[model samples]
Target: MKGTISHRDSFLAHIQQQLGKSSSKPASIRRPVWKHRVNWETNEGLSKEELVEQLKVQCQQIHTRVVETTPKEAPSTLRLLMKEYGEGPVMTSSDRRFAQYECHPMFQALQKEGISVTSWNADTSREENIRQAEQAKYAVVFSDYTLAESGTVVLSSHQGQGRALHFLPMMYIVCIEKSTIVPRMIHAASALHRLVEEGEQTKGAIHFISGPSNSADIEMNLVVGVHGPVRAVYVLIDDE
Candidate 1:
């Protein structure tokens, strides 16, 4: 009977062997330090103008348009954008930013130009609302922060601010306040994390977007807007 081992005996022996080599000490897994606890200091010498210039260059490299304007000039800038890009069957964000944009004269101007500008968050049939965004030539949203180092804008996802507003449209425009510009993505993440932890804002997810979505996956050919907006724009609001 000892000449050959049964499957059960073999399995038990394997388990015993594993247990014999296993450490008896408690696991010492190092947890990731949250942003707030980090001690690293980023360089603070760069002025807002310098940061914006850096961001503009990076954005253009990735084919995203960067428009610099004060709050007072934003409406005119938007009007020019519509003219340059051609008025869109546009869908605006349902987020709080919509209310802000609506107060602008450009909103009325867009309507006067016979451009189909609609809200993604309006009280309408759910399918109809989605259809509007899906068919939109341009979709608009507000950025929580713009990371200058990478020319990335951070979007907070909520019921009012859906992913559709960022990715589904052919062109995406982000209304970012100059005051929200951070030197790096880590700084932006840390700020958002603190806000979430302190219950200052509630959001489902945070999106760190850099330029128009592009991938060099198919035959190494760089293709843009395959999964997201083909063109992305940043409206830098000087007066927050």
Candidate 2:
């Protein structure tokens, strides 16, 4: 004997019946209104300088270092950071911002000093890029956004930057522009939402990194650098 299978509509209808509700869909769906907009309101009135201070305080709690410098002074500041983080096999993302901020020349200067520095090459194979990142003592990338409240640096991965570049290195250095610092994650979310609404192509893996990789065991003893860079630093450039 052959058995008959229920159609999708009938299966759904049966479920609706069991729940004692009509199978017909609602005429119009409405999004629920939020009773509180604390996420959008917190630190909303802070000036840029105040926000920078807030970010510094948050970074302190997260064990990440924050350095402030003007765009003209950024190269020297970065060089200092590189020295403090120790010798390298350094890797950096091929972000155009390096040249825009006038720091691209520093990389060339480092090369002349005989330090091995590699930038993410779009033409290179993934395996090669991963190998370079894995072997590097430090990886530096520019932040797309920095959240003041959480000391998080937002990184978006594209052709010139892979996810491994941020995670495979021993130390992570982020160049964050002061203008890109937001009060919290909500501001970043809203900006991204607007981009999507305006039909902008924002395709990439968005990473919200709070600090160096750290986790606690069952006994509550925290261990750092288990899964990612052991040290993280944010060099905040006062571009504006």
Q: Report the C-alpha lDDT of model 2 over 52-90, residue by residue, as the tens digit.
A: 999999999998998888888988998998887687888
| Number of the predicted model whose lDDT against the real structure is largest | 2
> What is candidate 1's lDDT per residue for 1-240, written digit by digit as tens?
568656976677678788885434347767677766333355356888888888888887888888888776766776777679877787777666545545345676778878788876646766787788789998877888998888899987775667667788888888888989988877887788888778876777788999899999989999988898888889998864
> In model 1, what is the error at residue 200, expressed in angstroms?
3.0
Minimal lDDT window, size 10, model 2: 195-204
How many angstroms is residue 54 displaced in model 1 relative to the true structure, after the best TM-score fit?
1.8
Runs off by more than 4 Å, candidate 2? 1-35
RMSD of 1: 8.2
Compared with the true structure, all predictions reach lDDT values of: 0.79, 0.91
Query: CA lDDT of 225 in candidate 1?
Result: 88
Clash number for candidate 1: 0
